[model samples]
Target: MIKRIAYLTSPGPTDRRGVAPGIVTPGFQMEFVQIGTPTLVNDPADLMITDLAYVEAAMRAQRQGFDGIVIGAVADYGLCTIRASVDIPVFGCGQAGLLTAAGIGDKFGIVTIWPETTAFTYDRILRDNPVGRQCVSVRYVSTVAEQAEIADEDGFYQQMQAGREGMMLRILAEIEAAVAEGAQSIVLGCNCMSPVASILAARSSVPVIDPTAAGYRSLESMLLLGLTHAKDPRLPAVSERGPAFAEAVAAVVGTLDEPEECPVCVLDEYGNASCEAPSHEAAPTSADGTAQ
Candidate 1:
């Protein structure tokens, strides 16, 4: 049977609007989804939006009947939350990138885009993977000015057309530096770097891993192995917290229709008969030991 997966991109809709999905390996069908709007230019604000959007998407993934979900960003926003919300496989690009590089060779380095995102990508990789210590360093491919230029559609394609000799030269330089730093392999730490990964691979003798491809392949492996993320401290199962869980979902995703009044009669935690307010602290948490 063909496995269906949802690939959720952390960027706003218009960032990669014209870019079409690449050819996927057989036996898997991927549907791409984006979180946030095109106007969210600031990295910090964009990340916050991506996180909330990721949570919303994660909630619907199971209901949508997807076999798994792959987070497209190297930062892997809302990865844990999504894993906890669904029984199917959940893949994070950052984790996959590092793990793939680790298996291929020891002492890998990351080549990411944008200086502002360097620290965030590094931190996420370390937090998600125990073998992250093998990652020696991270380097940038472009500055803010270059990034701004690439925002123009013509400029972006022009760079890609230039191949390794043109736009990819700086990134190649950084990858070489990693090799000097004892890095046996290199991981492309940004989803945006997918287009240039092959170029880097051809230019460098060592292995170069693309985070998005690594993440998707990781999902495929997990499915083939009949494995999913563990439901424990990393991704605890959700517990019903009175009507709040339903109510919150309803408020955001409209999972439930608003009651005309309070049709359903339910007793409060304090033995009070009303839905107006929690009669007491309500145990300070839910049955799953999570805060209500």
Candidate 2:
């Protein structure tokens, strides 16, 4: 059985908040690990700033003994490096998103945050899997300038509201265009859209693929595979440790004995509770042992 898993993400507890529940739903007992401190980059020249955060996450996951590592960003920064540095499988939300799309339909459309990143996202998809031809288009909802306008307000509620509305319209338009252009499904290209995918899908004729959930499900499959072939050298041994590993150990210890709220559902602006974490109550434990 896959008893433990780790989710490595960039700092900014709020940013981490968006993807955690997707990784720890029922059927999996996984710990969500955060790396680095919160960072905000306003200049396009500094856009790569998030890369450092992911690198830190990767290094921490390697030091601490994690069976697998899931990078939380949709941009998938440091994915290659993380994979190369770790013996265990390192999964990225972006890659999993693409794979999920391919599995569910002939073609998929990506809805992203920045227009400038569209090119980057496109290039990454193509380079990672040439099969990206199956992807219809990567659309951006909020450009850097747009996000800048509301980056500081109260949760950026007003801007996010406007952005979400605009995004919904853009997504609907893109879905219509993609369908007309031969796409059979749409992929939510950003982690923020994950909490609302089911709502989007419910209102649309085609299916909505949430990259975060897709990534989590991908990790689940890898865990099952690793557990099945317990002797595979590809799997990392559980005794790994390093000086920088204490944070991950602490994170696991903090969560293992407590019931964590569903991160996705909790962060949803709509107050929807569809995406919840695995119920700790259902976790099997001996009468005398604490639930993990």
Candidate 3:
């Protein structure tokens, strides 16, 4: 039977959008939706918007009866929250591509668009994967100027076509650098790079993995095996906080353009919550485990 999967996008998270083109395998119907206001994910404010948007998108996809959901960004925003919220197979492009490369090669290389953000995110996520250390090198591309010119799908396609050769050369150079650093496989770390994945794969000595393709194909394989995430330890819904706390918190953080100050005198007025993190400089003795 043909299964349905919702490919939820983070919009312009890295000045790029959606999965790399032409990676879908057969036997599954896929729906692509830009789930949030486009944001340049390297920016803290913008990244936060895309992060929470994934949670809402996953809930909607599950409610709509989709068989699976793919977080389209290679950075895989809100991966944990979405997986916990929904029972369906939630494929994160980063994990899919990284794990795929890990399985096939001794060490994989990542080439991303942004310099700092992706490297940091990959470092954090790689910790949870046993073979995460196998990701040897992460090379970055400086494509902000060109991507900023793109405003719509027509423009994006036009840009990709006009700059295809140039983009390929730049990416090819990065792939070479990764290989020099002992990367056995190259994983495209940005969704925008997906279009030229085949081109790079053909020219490069090592395998070139497109994260979008890996993620979609992973979800497809999971369905074929009738596998889904474990239902235990679900993200339990919040039934009650209070009209005061809910209203106050929402008013303070309702959107990206929220008020600088809490509208309700202070947040502690609601539920005794503080914007402070408990001091973790030293270990705590109490069983309740509030940090010391």
Candidate 4:
């Protein structure tokens, strides 16, 4: 039987969602979930909001009968929380790439786009550390301005084609720098860079891990083995915390304690609580400072 996989993208629908259809493997029916709005994950605070949303999506995915979950982003947003919340295996592209690379070679490095994304990719590598050793190096191949030109779905694909030889050369140069530092394998750190993995691998002597493909294969293997995350340390037993308490925790973590009826609630520009109503409002203030 074909496995049903929830492949969650870190960016909002407009950015990279269109490319998800091309990334799935043969034996899996993939359902893609976007994390949040494009502006929602621009910074660390926003990343936390996106992560919270991801956990909610994961719970829904489990109830909806997905056999496994895959996070397409390199940072692996909400990866652990979702794994703990559900019995199904959850794969993060960052971890997937690192583990796959480790099995193929001694040391690995990641090549990503833009400085912000470079930091995101490197931090995940540091956190996952699947190889048991630090990566040889982490490098960025594009500047913020350059990435801006190709941030859209069509532009991304257009830039990955042979017409953009200059961009490909820059990426190869960064990978070469990692090789100079003794990296024996390469992990394509951005999902948008998946299109070039084969090209990069063919040009080099070491294995090149395509982050999304690694994630899909890893999740597929786990499902075939009937293996989920470990129950002891990786996912401890759940406490008796009920729905009310869970909502409270979510409110605190997501900074979403504002009154739902308030119009401003729709505007969470910085992923924080929406603006409070005027003190003179007819609605009484709830104990939580929200209008009731």
Candidate 5:
């Protein structure tokens, strides 16, 4: 059984509320690591900066002998690289979100944070999965600028207050919106939004998809299956001097000039993107002044 699991994330209220619980659930011992937040540079090419940070963090965790690693971000930032770099299994919240949503119903809608990210995420999902047609819709709660504003301390507090005060109303509106658009269930698409998931579900008739719960269950299953942190034998070792492999690593970590296309992007029926990448970046500063 998997006794120990490592949960890596950027420092943020969202991560604390959504990702941490997945690690410490009943049967597992969890270790949480904080990394840098992924800042959106003017050039899209700089996206690799965030991706590389996650890989570096995973390598650190693997060296420390964690049983497995879970990248705890709604975006699933650097999943592919972390998986390739480590012998242990690496899971992403985004994948958990999709898998969880799928288990409950035929179609689901995602309520994510940024509009641009919604588009980018949708693109990634379509590229990764063969069954890209199952998603119903993926909507953004706020634009990137708005998200950034709310991510700040005062803004976050106000947003939280708004959510709490108008909890039922917001939940009802979101549910009605999704159902009207043909969603059988709703997936809390943002990590920050997870704390309110059960509240949303409690107020709605349909089910709510909680990525944290999904990720926790997935880790539990991996433990039960006795999975090992062994390298995939199919892939050649770096010592084998495979230029392509080296190039791929270089493409992912070398520079901010060109961001490699994430390999795990896939689509569900509703056109919502499924992220399988692990995040690499500094953790966001938390309002609570505690490490998330």
Candidate 6:
């Protein structure tokens, strides 16, 4: 069963809601870890960078003997790759909240932080799932610029509390609007909104699900049941040394303009990356040795 759960917040390490003081439970515990990379994620390019950070963070948690990893975002940024890479169960707030909403309500709506992330909610959480049909609308509390400013600031937690009362009322309005639009339930689309989750849930008549909490509980329950995502048929792994592998190693750990080769990325008996001597590049030698 899960004794420790790591909640990974994306693209940065500024959030302190669940970290500084931390949260406690009877049977297990949750530790919040910042991705500690590109400070914020506003678009697909940002997500590309943050995705790698999140996967690495999850792996680190697994290495530390954590039983489960809960990605603290409604986007579920690296959900697929993380699950494929780790042995423990991986939960994303987006999937967790959406699934929960589907189970309890005939129809639901999503109130996320802002516009750019709203796109992610539609693309990742709603677009493909049958539950998408039940998600009537995905609304936002503010503009992308507003969220970006807060995310970029050093005092993120303080900024989030700047107009706490106003933010709550705005979120409450969104929930009421969703209910008017035939929503039987609502899911807060961003996991970072945990600070105000209780206020939103209390003021709103229909259920206002806190995605972070949903994901946390989901992982905890899965652990108790001895369950996790299917990893059979094994996920993709790099078997050859190439530009692709070299680029990752460079970006993450070094400054290689273009390494000729990278250590062969092979999965050891435990599904861990075990490298051997290099020289696996696919560049072909010409018939004339120097020319084609």
The candidate that achieves the highest lDDT relative to the unseen native structure: 6
Say which prediction, candidate 3 or candidate 6, comes out ahead on TM-score.
6
Tens-digit lDDT track for model 6 on 95-156? 88889999988999988655434464356558646677889888776653453333233322
Which is the winner by lDDT between candidate 1 and candidate 5? 1
**After superposition on all CA atoms, how large is the RMSD of candidate 5?**
9.1
Local accuracy of candidate 1 as per-residue lDDT tens digits, 89-125: 8988778888888898879998765554346536655
* lDDT of every model, 2 decimals: 0.59, 0.53, 0.59, 0.59, 0.54, 0.60
TM agreement with the true structure for every prediction: 0.72, 0.67, 0.71, 0.72, 0.70, 0.73
Those runs of model 6 whose alpha carbons end farther than 4 Å from true positions after fitting are 11-16, 19-24, 116-118, 144-163, 234-292
Relative to the true structure, candidate 1 reaches a TM of 0.72
Per-residue lDDT of 1-292 in model 3, one digit per residue for the tens? 7778898863221222344445555677887654433222433343454466556667767777898998876767778767667778988777888998998879888876444333555665577567779988778764434333233333332333334676667778888999999999988776556656677899988999988788888888888898975655544532122333334333434444421211100112122211222222232111100000
TM-score (C-alpha) between model 2 and the true structure: 0.67
Supply candidate 1's per-residue lDDT for 236.
Answer: 44
Q: What ranges in model 2 sit over 4 Å off?
A: 14-27, 37-49, 152-167, 227-292
Better of 2 and 3 by lDDT: 3
User: For residues 1-292, what per-residue lDDT tens digits would candidate 4 score against the true structure?
Assistant: 7889887753322232313565556777877754332213334554565566667667667767888888766677767777677777888777888887888877888776544433643575566665737588778765544433332433422464332776677778888889899988888766656656678878765677878788877887888788887765644444232353346434644553333222111112222323332221432221100000
Error of 2 at 10 (Å): 2.2
Lowest summed-lDDT stretch of 10 residues in model 3?
A: 283-292
What lDDT does candidate 6 reach at residue 112?
62
Show where candidate 1 strays beyond 4 Å.
10-25, 36-46, 153-164, 233-292
Tens digits of lDDT, candidate 5, 71-187:
665556567767666777777766776777777777877755334444654445434543335567776554445433432434432343235555446446756687788888776
lDDT of 4: 0.59
